[model samples]
Target: MTTLSDQDRARIAAAITEAEKSTSAEIICVVTRSSSDYWAAPFLWATLVALVWPWPLISITNLTASTIYLTQLVVYAVVALALSFPSSRRMSLTPSWIRRRRARLSAREHFFTQGLHRTVNRSGVLLFVSAAERYAEIMADDSVSVKIGESAWRPILDALRGALARNQLADGVVDAITACGAILAKELPPRENDRNELPDKVIVI
Candidate 1:
């Protein structure tokens, strides 16, 4: 979990302002700490570690049944506690498909939560980044999607991922927003009466 500083927030807000200048589409940026807690993986691993404790006691040591059971209980408790640490819990042990599924679901939730679905022209675009999962999603409202194919978003996502990998999250977001704005500007130019429909500040979760 990286937290954006006030300077980073200001830059993103400026970028949003610049991006919306020529487009009716409202672009909302959201960066979440994670997509999922992924507690099951750590719990499963701890259980497996605990199950192996009885083997060594039965084969190499002359421990009594009660003692072995108590030792196993301790092992389970210790292992679970160790795995519960933030760094250990954040391991990418979840399957790729699961990560992708979770990220997509989270993005959809934010889409409606951020009012992208209710934009007057149906041209809201959401650039969602999940730091824990290393996933980025570009979701657009119906009007924008109808004009720009899904494949067109791939490059923008790739750029964002690259920036995140380099620990340049804010930069990645600004660039992606700028790229998306260009597309939206071309496809859905601002109307004479176009008004800012959403907050320009970046949302952190």
Candidate 2:
């Protein structure tokens, strides 16, 4: 697993600080282990396997009802425990689309939770990452989004995706912030009295 060190955190914070110099945009960066626990995945898979394991015993074995029931219980317990592991839950059991969707929702939630929406000019941008899902999103408040349009963010998101793939998170975030700063500078130049409405440090969860 790629881990974000303290050094990476500091670098990310510096990037955000530097990026905000020319633009009034308040950029908040967040990184999370995962968007969701996906507790249902293990149980759902275990249930399906356990349900079929007993049918084989019922058809060909001489086992009594109580014995078969106990066997099924053991199967369910073992399968569920195995799948409960973090790697197992993320890689094999959970669907890709579901993981992406959960990450998307989480990014949106953090956009508001981080107070990015409350900036005076609504010039707030959220850079969110879900490590387990390998997902990244650039969420801008209405003012920025309206001025730049959503498609303008595709290259930024692509850069983020590639960085996540290579486990170069700090570099990716720095690049993303710099790119976002350039756009914001052109379309939403810093106001004379503008002040940071969000934290410059990277939020890790």
Candidate 3:
């Protein structure tokens, strides 16, 4: 769930109006599925070993365990470095979408996500990020042109579109920007796997 301020939502409505006329601005909102998995497969095993090995220092075997601990620490450090530099997901917030989303989701749920979505008042640009769940989709306004797959984006869009048609400018802003594009899906069919595949309801966002 998102929680953006009302002022930001107003700004987004302004931005969306600006976007409709500007063709150069390619607004891309990517909702990546299973996207933010930072825990490497080996992370848990290494951490467990490190925690257990430090207590029994008297045994000669504990000396070997210390070596294991150092190795584990190094590996974890390396992975952390990689994530901080290269693997971190770009988290952007459509302030209006946040406010709109908050109507549907809780604040604690969106805690770790880094918010970067800022409407540049008619300035054409792009915004992309990976979200939760296991699917993604692209929309051209209220109409979803490309159903990439099911993910957090789908549900979010559904809510946004609902808000739009009803003339709810706040939540409608998200729908205003999200349009169809090259969708990356992994085996999950957009319709069959979708959790919120309601008919296109522009007023629901």
TM-score of each: 0.91, 0.94, 0.25
Given candidate 3, what's the lDDT at residue 101?
43
Q: Model-by-model lDDT, in order?
A: 0.89, 0.88, 0.35
Q: Choose the strongest candidate by lDDT.
A: 1
The digit string of per-residue lDDT tens for model 3 on 1-205 reads 2333567455554454434332322243322222333444334444555566555654545467567667657766654444443333212211334333432232222211222122222211222222332122232221122323336356655655555445453444454354321231221223322222111112111
Let me know the TM-score candidate 1 reaches against the reference structure.
0.91
Question: Whole-model lDDT, candidate 2?
Answer: 0.88
lDDT of model number 3: 0.35
> 96-135, model 1: which lDDT tens digit per residue?
7888898999999999999999998898999999987778
Clashing pairs in 1: none
Candidate 2 on 13-93: residue-level lDDT in tens?
A: 998998899888899999998898888899999999999998889999899999999999999999999889866454558
Highest-TM-score candidate: 2
Error of 1 at 65 (Å): 2.6
